[model samples]
Target: MALFEIDESSGLPVWVQLRNRFVYLIKTGHYQPGDQLPSVRTLAAEAAINYNTVSKVYVNLESDGYVESVRGRGVFVRDIGGKADDVRSIADTEIEGCIRRCLALGMTIDEVTLRMMDVAHRLKDEKS
Candidate 1:
């Protein structure tokens, strides 16, 4: 199982954080179609979070067509075609929010761009 790190200090809610992590895994091919995910209880225990929190994240993913739940079995990754566009939109929205916040903080566009690049590099390194 892949481990996910949750930043309690981040502005995003825990459930959102969990959901985004799963999305990232799926997008990166860490999780593949028909692959079964750990049960909500197991995932919560491993993540050290509430079971309901994990459940809610899985439920939201299912509703978004990224995953499907099987009776008596766990959740499995679904063959969600065109999910890249959805992921891209979510990423664009997040970037826009960050840019807005940086502008509000009186940061120059160049400075914000540099910072974004630095953060992107760090994220790429972490993933590798």
Candidate 2:
């Protein structure tokens, strides 16, 4: 099984960190279709967190259609269909959250757009 690192001091909750890590693993092909995930107990032990926390992350991922659990077997990664609608929905939600945060910080739309473009360009360059 692959190892995951968790930061105890991060602003994000532990469950969110685990969920995001799992998503990143799936997206990066570190975990493939039918790959068995570590049990909640095992993952919790490894992460030094409560098992319930890991369970919550797995439950959310399963509900989101990213994984499936079999009665007698461990959880497995599902085949992501690359559904554009689902992708767009997730992206829209994330963008909305970012916009809200920027607005709360008193940033104007133009300033936000400029900063977003700058980050986008940097990401594009990094990818290249």
The lDDT, on a scale of 0 to 1, for candidate 1 is 0.87
Candidate 1 TM-score versus the reference: 0.67
Each prediction's Cα lDDT score? 0.87, 0.84
Residues 26-119, candidate 2, lDDT per residue (tens digit)? 7667788899999999989887879999999999999999899997899999998664255457778999899889988999989999999999
Cα lDDT tens digits, model 1, 1-128, are 24787776689999999999999878767788999988999889988989899999999999998899999988999987656567677889999999999999999999999999999999766755
Q: Show where candidate 1 strays beyond 4 Å.
A: 84-128
Cα misplacement distance, residue 68 of candidate 1 (Å): 0.7
Which stretches of candidate 2 lie above 4 Å from their native place? 83-128
Top of the candidates by lDDT: 1
Q: Give the TM-scores of the predictions, in the order they appear.
A: 0.67, 0.62
